[model samples]
Target: MANLAAVVGIGQTKYTTKRGDVSIAGLVREAAANALEDAGLGWDDIEAVIIGKAPDMFEGVIMPEIYLTDALGCNGKPMLRVHTAGSVGGSTALVAASHVQSGTFKRVLTVAFEKQSESNAMWALSTPQPFSVHLNAGAGGYFAPIIREYMRRSEAPYDVGIKVAVKDRLHGARNPLAHLQKPDITLQEVEESFMLWDPLRFLEACPSSDGACAMVIASEDLAEQSPKPPAWIRGVAMRSEPTMYAGREEVSPQAGRDCAADVYQQAGITDPRRDLDCAEVYVPFSWYEPMWLENLGFAAEGEGWKLTMEGATSLDEGGDIPWNPSGGVLCSNPIGASGMIRFAEAARQVRGDAGAHQVEGAKLALGHAYGGGAQFFSMWVVGSEKS
Candidate 1:
């Protein structure tokens, strides 16, 4: 049987459009240092290092892990790099956890970062590739139509997306590290915002951010010895499918459903809405909040939008299951690091360390991320108890 693993430390750099004070190496190093400090461990304590990020073009740097090894204190230790588009962050953390769970390492450090300000991310992601269609522009162009499709099928109120935009921005105001701070954002402001992509308004879409996230995963024994409370890894799962296929359900991809199902089963959860205290899902666009609620089994098909309308996912509204107390990707999107931010925030909730945004007495939480035309999916369930 595999050994148990948990998150002993979590860290994140302030999310913003540009972090001119530091280079890419410095960006990641800052987060890594914070994670080590939080864990009360030194560089020598980390047995292995794993890093993840978006494509090399996003930062104009190829094979960043090679040069970053020394910065992360992995000079003579094993180092690995993981890439799964936007889902890279969550998957990278999972890989680090597996190293300890599989009895291959006692303690491991995982880092994910994206300096989008340094490079033209839209151009990098939209560049023509062989055998792939490029009819759409960047992510907004690709996902806008999908959102429309979901709206048509679900017949959800048009204001649902607007409500999510305001709610998450309000949530972001409470997160000191969040990129956008809209303490008093209103639905009227969102409704009046210019439409970037039909249904997606300027405020409804996530901002381009330059930031990083890091975590320290340790074996059960090491986790128990840590100074801070550890968020036990109850379950972790990843799934993927071809980006383009005939009859593909882009609204709620099957890969996402399977991944969520797998993780829920491992965590012994039959009803996510009732069993989980909260969720930090990857929702770069406001509409994705309800879309993912259904995909993750938090709501029945075609009924997810109702939850948003009823404030079920709002932390400040005293909802039953708050979705993004840390403001989620909608408020801070560093692409590669966004997903891991979700995972880290979930851990923070369970550890009772999420400062102003903490869900009261949260014992279990969910973290989720999806990327690559919504084909790549990664998720994890975490809890305060080891069982």
Candidate 2:
């Protein structure tokens, strides 16, 4: 086991389709600087650095970390890069936490970013590969079929995806940093939106944006010395399965189920719905809200759809387990940074500083992410009280 670690600071840039105002290096520094400022420190305070993002093709940059050294104030510090498909953001954070938990570093800086404006992620993903049928469509086309399978398996209504789209978009309006701020988005509008993929409407899908997220992870001693409440890292876990296997279940990946179970067990949770106050999960597509509910054990199989139908996951007036109060991946998806945003937002929730989307009296929260054909998974449990 590793030593206790806590998130001391979190930060992000205003997410949008294009951040032409800054270069890739500048984008990451902007977020890192914000986190450092929140932690009441500077570059010197961080003992090491870890950064993550999608493939370099997404930004037309080859191994960005190599050139971002000075930009991130890592000129002479140990810097590492992490990649795990879309889960890279959360994985990066977990790696930084490991440094502090292992007693190898007292404080570590972790950042994840994506500048998709430089290129096209969907095109990069849809590029033909050997032994693959070239549907020639982007991610929406790839995921739409799996979503259809979920609908059939759970017998979910068509409105389920629309409801989630509306809910998360509304939530985005409350988040100043989210890419999309559609406060007036309505379910009917989402239903009528053009379909990108069968059963997957445009509004139901996540946006491609440019953004970055950063966090300062520190040991318990350093966290206790800080003025702000520390988001204690109670548990952290990551798992992966083959991208495609004969018996694999993409809609409800076993890796996702196992990841949640491992984190819950480590955090002393038996009932996720009640034990955790809220969850910031990776839901790039609207239907994933219910799909993840089943995968993460928030609801029983074939019953996750009812939760969305009843508004249990709504931050506006939901119960203890509201999901993605920050609007989730649907609102702000900077591919590499999406998972880190979820992780950071979860920390913000437990820290009681999520602003408009804050869950009332939230003390404990969960952050989850999955990627690469829903094969890679990462999750963590955070709490307000130090232990």
Candidate 3:
């Protein structure tokens, strides 16, 4: 059995379209330093380090973690690099936690980053892969038709995407670290914005950003030494399925369903809607909010959009189950770091450190991420208590 592990610290740099002020190493260091500061620890306190990011082509740097070791203070310590497409960040954290859970380490440091200004992400993502369709419109192009399929099957309102765009942008305004903060954003603007993908407007798409996120995971004994309350990790899980196959439901993939089911079961959650206090889900595109809701079993198939229309996912006082109170991928998507942001945000909430976006009395929370044709999934549940 795995021993207890807790996320005792989280830190992130100010996300933006371009972080010209810092080098890739500097960007990674900034986030790692902040997390160390939050944990009240120094470089010597860390037992190991794990770093993750997207393809080396995205930043034109090969095995960045090797160079980032000095910046992240991993000298002479075990360091691992993880690349699981966009889900790398969350996966990185899970790998770090595994160290503590296995009784192999007392404390672990994990970081993920993306310096999009170094290279063009769109150009990298759009490159034609062997045996894949050559439409080459980038990720949005690939996911848009899938989104359209969800719309057709669900019969959701035309404004559902607009509503999510408005909600998340407004939430982003409150999070100073977010890249896009449109507090005054409205449904009308999103509805009128130029359409990039059919049924997906420009305002609804996640920005290509340069940013980093870091966290410190520790054993139970070490966790109790933290100055701030620890966000105990109740359960962590990952799942993957073949990228393409006949009759696969990309809209609600079985891998995603299985991932969520496994995590919730690990957390002993029988009724997610009523049991969990809040959730931070990966929503790179506005429509994904509802699509993931069904995949995660938070709402029934073809009815997830109804929850959005009714404001059930709002951060406002009107909603009970606040989703993405930190604005989520729709706000500050540093591709490689987006997934960990969701995971870290969930830990922040349970630790009562969410600041303005804090969900009051959120004893338990969920963090989720998916990547690569929506086939790879990663998730975790965190809570205030050790249990």
Local distance difference test scores for all models: 0.94, 0.91, 0.91
Q: Per-residue lDDT for 269-361 in model 1, tens only? A: 999999999999999999999999999998999999999999999988889999999998989999999999999999999999999999999
Return the TM-score for each candidate structure. Answer: 0.99, 0.98, 0.98
RMSD of 2: 1.0
Q: For residues 286-334, what per-residue lDDT tens digits would candidate 2 score against the true structure?
A: 9999999999999999899899989999977565579999999999999
Alpha-carbon deviation at 98 in model 1, angstroms:
0.7
How would the candidate models be sorted by TM-score, starting from the highest? Answer: 1, 3, 2
- How would the candidate models be sorted by lDDT, starting from the highest? 1, 2, 3
What TM-score does candidate 3 reach? 0.98
Highest-lDDT candidate: 1
lDDT of 3 by residue, 50-128 (tens): 9989889998888987788889888899999998987888888898899999999999999989888887888998888
Error of 1 at 6 (Å): 0.5
Quote model 1's TM-score.
0.99
**lDDT of model 1, residue 107:** 96
Q: Please state the error at residue 180 of candidate 3 in Å.
A: 0.6
